[model samples]
Target chain A: MVRLSLAMILCLLMVTSGCGKAPSESSSKIKSQDPASVQNKGTIGFSALTLTNPFFKVIADNMQEEAAKHGYELIVLSAERDVKKQADHVDEFLVKGVSAIILNPCDSNGIGPAIKKANDKGVPVFTNDIKYDGDEGKVVCHVATDNYQGGKLAGEAMVKLLGDSGGKVAILHFPQAESCQLRVKGFHEIVNAHNGKTKNAKIEVVATLDGGGVRDEGFKGTKDVIESNPDLAAIFAINDPSALGARAALEAAGKADQVTIIAFDGQQIGKQAILEGKILCDPIQFPDQIGKVTIEQIIKYFNGDDVKTEILIPSKLHYKEDAEKDPLLKG
Target chain B: MIFMLLLLVILFSVLTVKQQHPTGANAGDQVGKTILAQYGKGARVLVVTRDTEEDRGFAQAAIDRLKAAGADVLGQVNGSAIDARKTIESILAEGQTIDAIAANDVTAKWTVYDRFPSVGSAKCVTPKPYMWPNFLKLSNLMSVANQTAIYAIIAIGMTMVIITAGIDLSVGSLVALASVSSAIFIRDYCGGTEASVTMVVLGAFVGIGICAAAGAFNGLMVTAFQIPPFIVTLGMMMMASGLSFRLAEGRSIPELPSAFFWLGRGQTFGLPNPVLLMIVLYLLAHFVMSRMVFGRYIYSIGGNEEAARLSGVPVKRVLLAVYMICGALAGLGGIMLTSQLSAGDPKFGLMYELEVIAAVVVGGTSLMGGQGKIFGTLIGAFIIAVIKNGMNLTDVDPFNQKIVLGAVLTAAVLIDRLKRHA
Candidate 1:
């Protein structure tokens, strides 16, 4: 147990050190373009949806590192999914006279006045992960993962696993989430297209159950579906937690190998699940890239460059092979 | 409670010491003076400012001072870094060399000057930033009051309800209901964006009236049916939240007229409208609690309901009024929130009932219902706001902030319990 703990610590240290240099190096490489403006720029304020989520945390960390390289300070605050709190953070940012402001808006529409406030102050507002589509405030740029494409990738992974002889499938869905909806839509498009191409071996979606985008709900939904349909071919979960939950339910029902799972969000746990052969694979989002790109846009905006209104970072499929190479998971 | 509020104010003020950038006319005039000193008469100057009212004031002052002092005003960029970049590009293209760029402090931070080699950032003249605590800034103080006004206003009703030995968990949901109702009233009945001032005011009253009805229902249940206030309010909380979602179709209503924003965002006498409204409501509530017959009856019922009835006090009516007032104020909070955020969301007022109750309790108001002060609740609300703002200014960890807030609430309650025991 002691050895395992030590090994984990070492692995974590390696991962942190490896990641710490990446954003700075890349930012420096970008800074090579404008070597003249290398002195102290100013401060950038970021209010995240919640830092409790490792996704937002990663984004904040990468942004801080990247901003430091370009001689800027990043002040991060967690809004805890409260729009009022996020608005207050924006107000505080304005009060502090920040050079730029970034937000993962708690409410796309409710956050409009706060964005308008920043815009009025001439502080550039950027968003990531959560896009603000309100008509009131102007967002200089938005950087986020392409959830639809990630979903399509998940669907393609489904086909690759069972394209030869497809059977019955179930979907663990969270319809309320816009990103999840896009994922399911992309998955459906790909699966339906695959079915249309081959008549003999068709994948039939027998059950589409609400998993609440959470592990406990996913576990219960999977258990109920397994009881009704014992010959289920596969399950497509909108995210990692639900996928892992489905795997646990399948194992509990003594049908681990009988069913396969394809998930989105290659969170550390999801990768570990793939490495352990509990879940198949995941289409991962690049929160790190989102953070880096957001800072890049802010720098360019300050540098008198016209930035794109929206930037979508592409998601990558992570199989067991990629998980094995991950330093955080290595002994 | 006032001491607590004062202490927090001082603490946050000290912690938030930062460089305060100058804007508006005076700073612009200062920058103009500096430009004149460095570059003598007829020095070509480009006036750069953000397109805000304050920045425009700065630009006006700078342009006036520079032109009056015989310096040539090349042009002005009343917009973004990109706009300033374009203006400078055009200026350079016109074969005109700028002796200086007159801009406000915020405008001076823009790295757009780096793009212009001849007119580097050094050529820009801005008023020097003064060192000051952010907490003490008039703008920050106004914002703190404005944000706290919602909780402070709602706490008045909560304080009265608790004073009468009753609780209202439904105020939070009522806030949402009111927000949704007002937004829908303006959008569907009144002409949304084209809504008149009279119609907008009427829409706000409509929102408050609905919550008042709900509050009246809560009072009826407690007074007539003899149900516990906690149980009744808990049930109402769920029902109102669900009803609001149903009415709103689970989406926020952002179609209200810009004039409607005056209540939440407008200022009077250099103070936020909500803060002014909170001050007025607190004054009225204090009067009712201290000088009025209704206030006396409320105290009697809270102190001893059976004894109050024996003493010819109208217990039921007072109770009903108290609940209704609580609901109405919560509705007002919802309206203020809608105006502040410029949207009426069913998700508005999330956990606000608890927040107001906390303020009431923290302000040294006993939950046992017979002893509390209206002003105490105000101080309590400010205390919470100060802590939150101070924590944000200090860059405290978000998770740790929750722990700190939890500790403060616990400590306040514990102190209350100990004081009661003593």
Candidate 2:
């Protein structure tokens, strides 16, 4: 028991350390373009939806690191998750004379005016994570993972674990993130397609719960699902943290083996769970890579290079066997 | 109180006509030049100013800046006497495209500010005009409801305790702890099948029960140890926060049941449920404080604790109940917050106690232990919310929002103080 606890602590420390240095090292490797060689003379301003979310932090950190390596400064501002604040931030960036801007907009529509302003400024803008409802010419690029595809894979994994017999499966979700909505769509579609996959595995997508993406919420959300669905076959979480929390509740109630758990976001803890055979599988997203891609596109645009408007970064689907093989999850 | 209201009316009147100028976005020669990057020879600008050489020179300076930047100065409004309606009407009569409007040396009043006709596709920028209706709006009202509900829940209970000459510093931290606990429960039980709702209710009750126990513990500390309620609750606040973090491992709980979400998101007849809950609670509190004999005991205790005890009031029991009630309300707030976010996070509602205290004090509740009303607190919350929401609509920066909240809080308190003196 002592050895196991020590192993877990060491693993968590390694993950934390890896997170801190990956960006700075990655950016340092990218050769800095000479200012004299700067045929692409323009600024790129990167504004995030909020600085509060650690998810956004990982993306922003990577973008800044890569941009710095390319000898370009990424003007970063936190909109604090307010749509209006994001709009104002965009407008301010526009007024500052940027060549192009990368926006992780807080709202789908509130950012339209700022987009227009940037358009008027003759600076190309790219959106990440969120899709904007505006003219294609107004935006230069939109890069994001196929959240729906990832969610479908999660559903498939759940069905495989539960078999052709259908049972109740509760989903812990976030309403604010459109990505979650896409995931829900995919999960429902995939589950419906798999008839008789289990003897009685009639997939009931229970309440679309909002965990607000917090741990205590994860715990509470999982506990609620379990209590509400006594015969629940499996739980599908939007993210790994929620999955870990659900695991905690299941352990507490001594129902650990009875219910299968599947989740999105191949976070470190989720990887640990998969390796231990506690969870079915987790679909991993490369947020840092997404950030790097966005930065690269901005740099390319500044260099008079035409880049694709949409960039799709692939997700890694990891089962227990795959997770155990990964060096990041190795002892 | 009457004098304060009278002064507000007077202040409102004086502030309205005292200063008038287009402070918000209005296209002018300067704005046109900035936007166009070169003054258009045929561009129109509406300049609002006093009919004096100095005022005209300022307007001209702006015009020159615009022209140099690339815009034509087309029109001007020289009002020697300030009349918002008449002033705006005169500007429209000029037949110039209102490219940008700039207010010079004028206080913006709410009544005259709202009278400006459609800006006609021109960008308008001006100092925010203070309007009563804008101050009392839906968005602003919602923000106030959120901010006020955070503080008022605890404050109402604190008022009852303080009226009995007791203090509860722990109420703040207790609120945080309870919120964290509730957040944890709701996050776990929120998305399940039919039982999810039942699970969430159970979690809420358990979380509240934990808070009530914390309150009861406070009562026991004071009663058993003969310790001051102030010291006891203050100590509890620190310990509670520590316990919450230990339980949560510094993680925030996010997911929660939709039913609880309704507490934060639900609206009846265009008002947020949290605000509606606050009103209902306030009314209930008012009734309990004014109509019940317990209310009389509380006031008597505040006026003279020893005398109330001598007069046959169960002073110790009342004190304990008061603290317990305060704790429970704090727990209720935590639960409501859980509903709002649909998550249980131990770290949630941290430092919210201060805001609650501020609302209580600002609501004309005497911190000296007795004088206050639930209705006054509701108004206090409104005032804070108006400043925040109004600032948001006017495009004030977030940092500025804090400064504005501080200023409004101070002003409200000052107004109350003045009333006392008057």
Candidate 3:
């Protein structure tokens, strides 16, 4: 009975609080700008699934710098590796009436409702780095590096580094992302191709580890591979961070120079390593270009033009010498 | 001794887990970079003893000097010297690398490892401490206190149930369901109008009370039907989870009306309403446990069920009420969570059951039943929250945070066990 009474009181508080006050005529305070009078010149919001990763931070900075040239406000909000929080940020943008949104989804599926809401409200939305797997027609446009092609490049690079006698190669992949899966698939396509081409050095995939898309996991997974197979001739990492982590582990095991390491998404660290000849090769994806193109697509959507739903950005292979000289590959 | 041994085993497992980094220099550098980004660039943080009063301004001045040079600075103090020691030890243990240490008090003890830059050894006379934003500081404190309160309310009921030699795992799920249901009713049905206020309150209570009935169902199954508490609550846990998912309609319901939001989000006399509600619930539970005839019966049943039955105590009815109380408190926690999030995602309370149980067990509540206190669980809950929040502020690796939490949980249980033997 006491519990019931307290529950009743709590309910009463909630009800009274809801009725506490109306929005003080603020709804009428700012009259809606006419569609003809709408001048799109203000802060541009970048909402990421998570800003915890260094890759995302780089993307955000590039976008922020580019947006500054147009006198645009760049509000970067990190979802702290949470899909719900990312969704919340989307809602916040809609309420705040942002000019445009650039999203890096935590999960392709979870952002569906939020993306739909923004589209219905006539807010142009663009996605970069990661593409949604759901109906591609729903989002305005997506700009991302071909993860599958990059993975195949890494695989081909590894096979070449291993020479004619294909030795054991380990694959470290992120389990949740389709992009990561595609990278592994591409790598296998190349590695399997080399199996028929190479005689003595046939690349054998000894083990595959799920790195969970974290550097620490990559390090641990690399160690696990080494421990399980001491003669791992090469390692194909899903991304640059994981490749670096794997290299760190290999260095610890005193086999850094012996095993050729290859990574995707040629991030700064990966580029630096490539310049220093630490990695065999890393595929360079212009994240900044992806960001810029995403905004351009959003703008096109806002202009009432039928925008192409898909935008695939090709990746270039970054060897030690190429990354050393190319300033674009530096970051 | 056994409890200590178990704690030692857990600690050893965590510490000896094959470290991937050989030199650990690179990992340490990465961790430092992460810390710098999280806190800010070139941040000089001072972890001090709680006993040091704010009047000692030298350290504050030193921190200020560092900050003026484009460095971010932060300081932390806990309840006591022992706590300070534990906090530092946990940080070092998790960090696995120390760049520097600065101290004056007992410098002779740990100064040997202070190979990094040492600021000073002289103790300051007056410490002009920094102040946090009123809202943020209050919110942090309230979060800890509110978390404790929720655990306390549930612990009181749990203690009662245990005293009657009973247990309830279904409480966590029931809490989630009740909170979600009440939030929906308030936001959707009531819609924050003056006339709907009474109805909203009634809706919340009715929602929670129905959950209590679910607990009563568990009690009835356990006592009347002669099933064990473990089996009964476990099954109810699944049932409650299914019910919540069905109610949420497979999507998060957000932007709850201000009235519903106020229930959990508002502040009363500078304390979060949830914290206040927890306190009120605690007082009522304390009264029911300490003063009521049913409370006596619960204790009697725990002391010896057969004897209590022979002694004319209504063991079954008391057990029923005890489980009902546990369910009701969980409902309250769920409601607060709903209010805080201003949304119901069916998945909001995932893995919460483990944390709640950890708090209860660490608080001295016996898994075997018939031993614990509401107050103990309250402290345990606060400790967990502090450790988590501190880890976040200190920029501990997410993986290391998990390891540290597991260690602390083990240590708490060990401490509880020692007290029991003593």
Candidate 4:
């Protein structure tokens, strides 16, 4: 009896919720698109790792525009880093009879079965940013930034900055992400090689702590390293957010002028920071390019063309000079 | 709760109505029949379809029907558009004129025919799509059930725990611990993919055993030392989560034996293993909660612990058993999730503690103590699952989906409060 009353109240409230669903054309009808509008080749479904991050939102927006130009519609959904929820999205895409499915897999291994399910249904799967490392599923193509190359650029910047006078350095790392691991690895290789040649100007390696690739951890980690190494010359953070976090930590400790921070991922904020001389420089990634190129590959796959299994977009280093002339940061 | 579930069913069904494309042998038969009616018997036909289970059925049925109708079936290409293009190019080179191209909706939409004007999409006959709610589809329904099975399984234990004025926040972390430990056991000790079924089963038990130990520790803290259940389980949650990450070295253990996959992915009696397991566990839980003496003791303690203790009820024992059972079921849920996703990662059960607790609260389970049914939790699980599934089907904004879920949970609690007052 209690449940019945609960049901009645819920019905009244949720009815409005259901009705407020935006009217979208009943898609994936299998029939040809209406002869009036652009004959949509097919709908493409994208299950992003998450859309809360502007990084993925950029990719989704670009993909939508690019797909529309090619006469295809894009249905973008965020899995919020839940592999099971991503799997459910794949199932829905399959039931909708979409042309292709794309994802930034939450878990490289755990998302295997979900991709495999799409493969069984004859729908091709593509990945961006995060690669599916598991062997169970087949992804037609993966489009992502070259993180290692970006890290190498960061290393070059570091060597240029601290190679003249040897100074102590700390690393704020996010080890869980494979991309970050590659970045740190590349950074280490360059630093080690630079140290091998110049003993007089050796940049002594200092504390390496996990920054969780986010602001709070980055701030805390930076605080810890500065306390231990008061003469810390520089901090190399994996991404823009963490770099900003390190800046905050340094400011809090009144050592903002003492430590130079080099971060990867030249997002708008990061570029603005470089312009303001907060960060030294950053290796910028083109999320827009990743999104556009992914659509091109999807077109090629459906157009009876051989598509490359992996496409890596290289990152470029941006200095304060470039940030001054950057179009994206102007407004 | 059942009435709410039924209403949700009707709500989603009405909202998600759309044209569903025909597939399988029936789709093939429809296409073949259309071809026969168009060009009549003695017509030469070519078939094109992608390589999939449904396409396979469609190809077989279409070929069978065309041949039975005395139509001259040419060649069938069951693969990508490239394969179809290759076949069509060769057929043209061989001077074979195709009268009709039998295809499904997917193949019919292909642009391969545009290259050969003589054999264009105009000559293709596809099965007509029928209007139906996507929610009502058998596959979608099964997926909803399969998706909810893990949560429902854990909710059974949570129901009991919540009934005793206690919360078990560690269930989510215990799930991850079980998944990673069980996976690691199989990969390292059982020879990975080459392990026998027995070895894999043993690995799973090892995973469960560790979580059970954690739960017992929680029970010990709560009963022996007089700690709050919240604080005890909360501490356990972090420790279990940290331990899993340390054991896994912050990487997913994907090298588990295939024999272990049967627990999560395999189906029994046409239902997924997790869903079937949920049903069986719920029945057992229902029996124990209502029909057993120990069940009465639990209720007596929850109803009034000091009074029940004076009346000779073993309060401490019952509470300890409840926490242990909660932990064990969480372990089971972890294993089931590992099987379902085909790998166990430290990232598997993020935020699942709140999800389960929401299920318990929505099922009319009171946080104050000693009320709620085993079956009520099941309905609550289904309610959450249906909302999620419906939102996905309707293409409602994912952000809005979160808002709706929060609203539903809040409403359920509010309604429960109102009912008590009334």
- Models sorted by DockQ, best on top: 4, 1, 3, 2
Better of 1 and 4 by lDDT: 4
Single out the weakest 10-residue window by summed lDDT for candidate 1 chain B: B10-19
lDDT of 2 by residue, A1-331 (tens): 3234323433432343344335433432341342232222233677787766667778888987887676565656676654444654554454333446888865564455567656654456788978775342267789888898888888778777655667778888876577888887888888877754444557777666776555678789888878877877888888888778888888988889888888888777778888988778987788899899998877665333557889877676789888868897854
Which sections of candidate 2 miss by over 4 Å? A1-331, B1-143, B186-194, B407-422
Each model's total of backbone clashes = 1, 66, 21, 0
The interface RMSD for candidate 2 is 22.0
Candidates 2 and 4: which is better by DockQ?
4
Task: Give each candidate's fraction of reference contacts reproduced.
Answer: 0.47, 0.00, 0.00, 0.49
| Model 4, position A189: C-alpha lDDT score | 86
Deviation (Å) of B280 in candidate 4: 0.6
Best by TM-score: 4
lDDT of 4 by residue, B267-371 (tens): 889988888988899999989999999888877777788998999988888889889989988999999999888888888788888999999888888877877
> Tell me, what's the RMSD of every candidate?
7.6, 16.8, 21.8, 2.7
lDDT of 1 by residue, A1-331 (tens): 3234323433432343334335434443553463333455667999999987888899999999999898887888888887988999999888877888999999878899999889888788999998896888899999999999998999999999889998999999997667888888999999999999998889889999989888999999999999999999899999889998899899999999999999889888888898988888899998899999999999888777899999988899999898989989842
Q: Which residue pairs of candidate 4 clash?
A: none
In order, what DockQ does each candidate have? Answer: 0.27, 0.02, 0.02, 0.49
What would the TM-score be for candidate 4 when compared with the true structure? 0.93
With candidate 4 superimposed using the best TM-score fit, by how many Å does residue B38's alpha carbon deviate from the native? 1.7
Model 3 lDDT per residue over B1-422, tens place: 22322333333233222211111223223333433444455655543422223212323444444455565434443222334345445555555432233232222122122222233222111121232321134334454465455555666666667657677777777766876677567657766333255776676686678788888898899888999888998999898888887887644555355466577657899887878887777677667666888767776788788898999988777888788877877776666666655555565555566677776666666655556666556655655655444333222334455666676566555555656666
